[model samples]
Target: MGTTQLETVPEPKYWHLRTVLSNALDSEFEVGEILPNERELAARFGVARATLRQALEQLELEGRLQRRRGVGTTVAPPRVGVEVNPTRHSWPGAPGDAWQTEGCAEDVPPAVVGRALGRGDEKVYTVHRVRTVHGQPVATELLYVPPASVPGLSGIAGLETDAGVARGRAVLRELQRLELGGQERTVELGSARAEDAKRLDRLPGAPVLVLTTRYLAAGGTAAVAVSTYRADTCRLTFGESAGTGLLAAG
Candidate 1:
């Protein structure tokens, strides 16, 4: 590979190094290829290890690289395009949904969810799900359903066994029985919580995209879903029939 020595520039040295490294990534690296260690990278670029670390962190945040726990930093795959607008809207767990049911339990939802459901301080059936692409987990979802929304669901005693998974499916089935209404959704940038970070194989406080959806039925909010997606590996797209192509981050 060719080396480009840094010249005096107005920008910070680390910032200039980040741009050089990014150009190298585009010209020389393939997806899933491990990058050189910090020492080698710093030496190659004629920069200190601290400067290299800053550049690597910036690249990782920009979705051009991934730093795994046991694995070294590698070129990340193109960001998965997640459609935020569909031509047809359906309930969660509907046919062809990418998320897999993990478990379910009765718990008090957060105050925001309670406000959306108009049920304050009441226990609701919370279903946990993980969304994967090409066998890699990319997002985690928590769906909260008030008892009044799924009155027919029963026999869910625990959330740590096979029965728990079955109960989760049952809750989804019961949810489908409701008359189709409408839904509202909002997306925001956030830091991954500890539990979500564990599920996504990221450090605590990693950047994430939080999507909140409120499903309406029977003249009230029937369910609320909060999905946390890895900002580095997923890009939310808006439009029906939008292709799954990663857009360049500005």
Candidate 2:
């Protein structure tokens, strides 16, 4: 007869610490209230600084806390409810739109975008935009407008060299001249890429809601939009809503 040893799996200590800290946040902390220093919190929780930091990082990703480089950590307010669905279709820079144009460039889009637009290796107008709510940057968008959609773009003076708010406006005006029939949209979860992370002011690989939209004109793909929203700080609503509550459980 032989004795066999049982295999024991250990749960990650940081995961357990995250739960404890989350409870404290709900019951004991107020929004915008700063917490104790990391060293003090680590001591209070009887965990190593690294473990404490792991938990804190999770909290920040969940939008439960805001960590500033020089300001330390504080409780975060409720996430913003962004209306995504409307009764009608409109251009990106339409009046009262949430996004502000950052710059415009004529470059080749990502492979996925190229496939969507049915253009291979062809350069298009890439309009960079930043969407904000309460003055906080929440999303970044890269809009790829094919040459066929804006035939007059080349005729427009200073379009290639212009890289400002006005540049985006000009492009939008040219796009608006076309008859926009409708658009198709798809949403999925994705990790923030390097460029989007810098614009969103979050660490690379943070969770985000990626939205891909295709604008159709005269039965052809006119433009494509790829928007990455901060998953923790935004609650995407499909239509009109009542109160400001998280649309889904985190």
RMSD of each: 3.1, 7.7
Error of 2 at 203 (Å): 2.4
- lDDT value, residue 96 of candidate 2: 59
Instruction: Give the CA lDDT, 0 to 100, for residue 80 in model 2.
Output: 62
Instruction: Report the C-alpha lDDT of model 1 over 1-250, residue by residue, as the tens digit.
Output: 4566676678888898889888888889887788989888888888889888998888888888888779899888777766676556789999878789998888999999999999999989999999875456789999999988888775445533443678889889999999979888888999999999999988899889998999989898999999999998888888754454455433
lDDT of 2 by residue, 14-72 (tens): 77777778878777887778899988887776778998799899888788888866778
- Number of backbone collisions per candidate: 0, 0
Candidate 1: global Cα-lDDT? Answer: 0.84
- Deviation in Å, model 1, residue 43 alpha carbon: 2.6
lDDT, candidate 2, at 120:
82
Q: Judging by lDDT against the true structure, name the best candidate.
A: 1
Clashes of 1: 0
Q: List the residue pairs that clash in candidate 1.
A: none
Q: Please report the TM-score between candidate 2 and the true structure.
A: 0.75
TM per candidate comes to 0.84, 0.75
